[model samples]
Target: MPTDPLERIVETAFDADVRSCRRPHSGSVAETAVLELENARGDVPRRLVCKRGGASIWTGDAIESAVLRVLEQRSDLPVPGVLASGKIVGERGSARETDPLERWACYEFLEGTNPGPGYATLEPTVRRRLVADAGAHLGRLHGTPGLEFDRVGGLARGENGTDLVLCEPTGWHAVDSDTLREQLPISVPPTGDSGRRPVLTHGDYQPSNLLVDDSGAITAVLDWGNAHVTHAEYALARAEVRFVDSYVGRLSRAERRRLRSLFRAAYARYAPLEAGFDRRAPLEKLRWVAQSGSNYARLLGDSRGRRQLWRQFRRLLE
Candidate 1:
C-alpha cells in the first residue's frame, strides 16, 4: 500500500505474483526491497531483491546489474546474481519509452543483514575481523585480470572479460556531474596514483553496501552503482577513510593505530601497497576531505565535523 513511486514501479515491474514485498533499504538515491515471489498457489517461494534506479539509469540499478553480472562470473566474491532487468513497462508512445538505459533491475536476495551505520553495534573484535576480511577481498577484486582495462574508469560486460564501456568514469552509482565533480582526484603521497594501474573499484565501498551473516562474516558485497576500473588506491583511500571514520567514530590514538595496522595488513594480503604506504595515510585522510567534499561532509554527522572538513580542504588547497 505504499504510495512511493519507486515502490509502485517495482511492484509493477514484478507484476502481482509476489507473496510479500518488504522494503529493507531506502536512501535519497535508491530504494530496495526483499520480496517473496510465489506462484498462484503461494508455493515455491523465491527470495529476491529489487533496486530501483535513483534518479537516472546511469546512477542506479542498470549500472549495478552490469557490475553484478561481472562479479558473479569473474570473482568468487559473494555478489548477487542479476535475475531480471528492464524499464517499467508502460507509457505507450511516450517519450520515455525511447530510452534504453533507463531500466530497473532485480537480483537474488542473499541471506544477510546490511549493517549500515549500525556497524558499530557489533563487538569490536568482530568489527575488526570484518574490516580485515573486506580489505583482503578488495585485494582479490583489484587483481582480477578480467577487470584490467587500458582506460581511466569504466564498467565491464558480464563475467566474459569483455571491455569496459565508459572511459572517463564518474563516481559509481552517481550519474550526476556534481557528485562526480566532488570525488575528483587529489594528491596524497605514498599511495599516490603515479604508477598505479586503474582497476575495478566498488566506488562506494561502505557498510550499507555490505551484507553480514549471523556469525559476523561478510556475506555479500552490494551496489556497484559507482563501480569502475579506476585508480584502485583512490578507491582504497576512500574505503579506509570512510569505513574507519564512520564505523569506528572519533578515532583516538589507539584507534588510529589499530585502523592503520589492521587495514594495511589485511588489504596488502590481497593487493599489496607500495612501501611507505602507512606513512601516507594521514595525508590520504586529509585528501579524502577535498575529493569527497560535501557528500563526505554530510556523512561527518555534525557541524563541527563539517567545519573541520572544510578547514582541511582549505589547508590542503594551500
Candidate 2:
C-alpha cells in the first residue's frame, strides 16, 4: 500500500534497521537500491544492494538469485553474493507474468564503479585491459562445467521442482518470419538446434553490467536478469557486437578489429571458440539487429534506422 515496499521487505528479510535507502537504478522492469544497514548490536556498518522486480517480459528475481547461486558455487566469476531474497510484501499486482510473487533479491554490496556508457571514450590502454578482462571472465563463465542445457531460453524450474529447464528467452519478441525476409532482402535463416551444447550466458553482457576499480581491474559483474541458456558461440557473437561492434558508426574498421582481437585473445585462454565463427557471427549478430530495428521502426515511423541496420547487416553478411 505504501508508495515503495522495498524498505519493508528489507527490514523483514534482514531483521535490521535501515540507515538509508537510495535507488541507484530504476528501469522499466525493476528498481535497485543500495540500503545502508544498522543491526541491534552495531558490530560494523553494512551496505546491501536490493533489487525489486516490476512488470516485464523477462525472468525476475528468482531466476537471478538462482543464477547467482550457481555461479557462486560453481565458478570463480566475481558476482555479488545473495544476502537475502524474499517476496515484496503486498506488491503482487506489479509482478512478472511467470512469477506470482513480486520477488526481491538483496546482494552484498560490491565495491567498484560501473565503467559508464562511454566505453569508446575511455583512454585507449584502460579500454584495452577492461575489454580483455571482461572477455576472460565471460570465457570462464561459459566454460563452467555442468551449466549446459539443450536449448535457447531462460532458466526455470523443471516439472519435478528440483532441476532447471528452459523457458522463452527474455526480450524475445515475436517477429514475423515472412516480413523479416522482405526487410533485409536476404535469407535470414533460423539458427538451427546446433550441435554445440547450450550454456548459461549473461543475457545482457555489456560494459554497464561490469564494475571496475581504479586500476581498471573488474571487481564485480552485475545484473543477471537476462541470464539464459544458449549456444556459447552465439553468446560470444553477441558480445562481439556489444563489446566491439556497437560503436560501428563511430569507430573505424581498424579500431573495431583491434578491440575484437583483444577480447577474443583473452577469451581464448579460457575456452576455444568453435569453428567457422567468422561466418556464423554475422548470422547471429543479425538476429539482434533485426529485433532492434523492428523496435526502432515502431518508434521512428520511418525506414532510416532500418536502412542503416540493413547496410550494416549486409556488410556482416559479406
Who wins the TM-score comparison? 2
Q: What's the CA error at residue 82 for candidate 1, in Å?
A: 0.7
Q: Per-residue lDDT tens digits of candidate 1, residues 177-199? A: 22333454533332234325567
Given candidate 2, what's the lDDT at residue 145? 78
User: Where is model 2 poorest over a 10-residue stretch in terms of lDDT?
Assistant: 53-62
Query: Any idea what lDDT model 2 has?
Result: 0.67
**Model 2, span 1-318: residue lDDT tens:** 223577777777767778888865422234577888787244323788877653122333246666787789889999989876655445446434335236677787888877855677877788778889989998898778777665566566444432455777544323323345556644543433331446788877888788888667799998876567766766787888888898888777888898898888788788767556666578667776765555455434534334434543554454
- Please list all clashing residue pairs in model 1, or write none if there are none: 172-225, 172-226, 173-225, 173-226
TM-score of each: 0.72, 0.76
RMSD values for the candidates in order, in angstroms, are 8.7, 8.0
Number of clashes recorded per candidate: 4, 0
lDDT of 1: 0.61
Best by lDDT: 2
